[model samples]
Target: MKPGTFLKSTALLDGTFFERSVIFIVEYNDKGAMGFVINNPFPRKLNELEEFKHIIPFPLYLGGPVDQEHLYFVHRRPDLIEGGTPVDAGILLGGDFKAAVKHIDEHTLTGNDIRIFIGYCGWDDGELDAEIAEGSWEVLEGGMLL
Candidate 1:
């Protein structure tokens, strides 16, 4: 799969934490695949975090089960925040955090234009393909889900 793909957990993944998870694939290559769960919220507001205290409140999502301490983001406002990595049409993976915060604080960026996530899902070389072969995930285009 390439970047901008979407992975939906199948029944084969039932009884696990990833069951029913919908992931937005941000990176995929010969080496590995990386993405985040877009539907699971972490029950915390964005403004509650020290780094985002100056910005408006927004929900924080549990991107996946890996690297839980780190933060990540996706957005459709590259015009407002420069240097973002494109994920799909009108969607960006990340950009300058300070600039984004500043823009948000200035009311130039609204919550509808951004999504904050913590952690991410990943698979080693060929691992994702193996999982897909085993019916663990259903791959589709990014637009189909998000």
Candidate 2:
């Protein structure tokens, strides 16, 4: 398993949720799969946006074709949070609108250290495994999922 890689759900096909979308899998296992969309970008910057201006400063990415109005984020700073699980050795993913705003207001966090996204990519049980066996997905190992 690589640190950053695109993992598409085999169960997601021809739906309003995930059509022709590529998701960067942040976590995966028997429990489930979690990821963010890489190709879709939200045209608004958080700092200038009315609702998120006080919360985040980063430009949001369209995490997936589903729920295009929700907010999600991935963070890498573990020192700020006590006992946060690492996505890798040094990377972590966690954020809420309130927490993000508080961190930003206090100048404790920066957009460079995190990424915001709208919606998310998900997979049900045994769905991704089938795709892996069918060779429809390619896994990569590196710093980021790009």
> Top model by lDDT, which number?
1
lDDT at 78, model 1:
77
TM-score of each: 0.90, 0.69
**Stretches of candidate 1 exceeding 4 Å from the true structure:** 141-146
Model 1: per-residue Cα lDDT at residue 48: 93
Residue pairs that clash (backbone atoms under 3 angstroms), model 1? none
lDDT of each: 0.84, 0.65
Deviation in Å, model 1, residue 115 alpha carbon: 0.8
Each model's Cα RMSD: 1.8, 4.1
Tell me model 1's lDDT, rounded to 2 decimals.
0.84
